[model samples]
Target: MKKVKQFGETVEGYNIPVLNEREIRASAGILYLLMFWSWILVIFKDSYLLLKYANMIFLAEFIIRIFISPRYSPFLVLGRLIVSNQTPEYVGAAQKKFAWAIGLVLSATIFLLLVVLNSDSFINFFVCHTCMIFLFFESSFGICFGCKFYSMFYKEKAHYCPGEICDIKAKQAIQKTSTLQRTVVIVFFAFVIMTVILFNDGFGAKPTSLWLIVKSAFSK
Candidate 1:
């Protein structure tokens, strides 16, 4: 799969990697959606009293990854695993560092959003609704709302280095997965969103701030 460079220089094939800014954002978006579901359980029959604890687990993971995960260690991880260890791609490594930094910030924001605004109504109205709108706009117009805002922070941001792969590979993986994996992925996200919506509604107006199902002893 050797190919000529833009400058007409000969180069060997690059192992196509799946990650880039868009895919990274999309994954963070999915994780935030999952956080929405975790909060939903807290708002429901109080069955998920552990929702708060779940945040603790994630916080611990982040701390460990930052301090202990070799995959995240400066000279040991990420690109070294993907691209050859001998010539670890600096571009890929830099992109991963940026992505991880953004993930940490996003994760902290989500944790605060859940802890401070435990109300299901707030999560549905602000987090879920806003993210859904952003995602739809991105998918429809090929515009990255976050990238635009992120660019405002730095002068050369617009000309920033995207990960190793070109636009073609990024879009392909972002758009498609194997059929069965797609089905499962679609169903999983749909279920999370619907569960958040339904449970939010059911718990929003309850006097005890909870919902319960009455079951006959013999039914089970």
Candidate 2:
């Protein structure tokens, strides 16, 4: 689909592809959610075939979105439908395209190394972990690390990046955390850490995950 240019937003006298920020993030959230679940299954159940297919799907989606059209990407189409009624948050699309290119590279690598080569290697693990990290940040917190990378190498930062991460520093309470909030967060984590350390079970053994635990409960 051809991007509809915004009435006035432009950088360096070039009309950028303006898009609904909410839909983009919503779509990303959906995709990441799928990837996270599939990866967890692979890690726990050793579902190599399932993981291979998932990687292939991600690779294809990225290729279509980047090379052909976003409308042709099934995940993005579903995402747009999901957020069709959402209020539009217009953002610069050039940086998003750049970010998608980065995603393309990651997905393509996973497809070639893990799915195609069928290697159960450390490098494949690293690639999958890195992909999850990137996706998790974006889906859960609306922080696009790829967009941050784009801003770092490029002169113009993403205008209206998600979560206003690229926004100029301004004096505001929201920008600064209160001492009480900081102390509460730190104390909470410290307490949890101490509780785990003090009453730990299976200190060296791989703990059974909630997924496995639930399955055992039902199967019995």
The sequence of per-residue lDDT tens digits that candidate 1 reaches over residues 1-220 is 2221111112244333222334333433444555557658756865444555555544554454444442333323232433342432222222343334453554465567665665444543454345445545433443445544544555643323343222334455766678899899999999999998889876676454222333443356
Q: Which pairs in model 2 have colliding backbones?
A: none
Mark the regions of model 1 whose C-alpha exceeds 4 Å error after superposition: 1-33, 47-50, 60-103, 109-146, 158-220
Give Cα distance to truth, residue 76, candidate 1, Å: 16
Worst 10 residues of 2 by lDDT: 1-10
User: What digit string (tens of lDDT, one per residue) describes model 2 on residues 112-210?
Assistant: 888777777887788877877877776677777787888788897677677677787676776788899999999999999998898687576787799
Clashes of each: 0, 0
Report the C-alpha displacement of residue 103, candidate 1, in angstroms: 4.5
TM-score of each: 0.35, 0.80
What are the runs in model 2 whose C-alpha is more than 4 Å off?
A: 1-15, 202-220
State the TM-score for model 1. 0.35
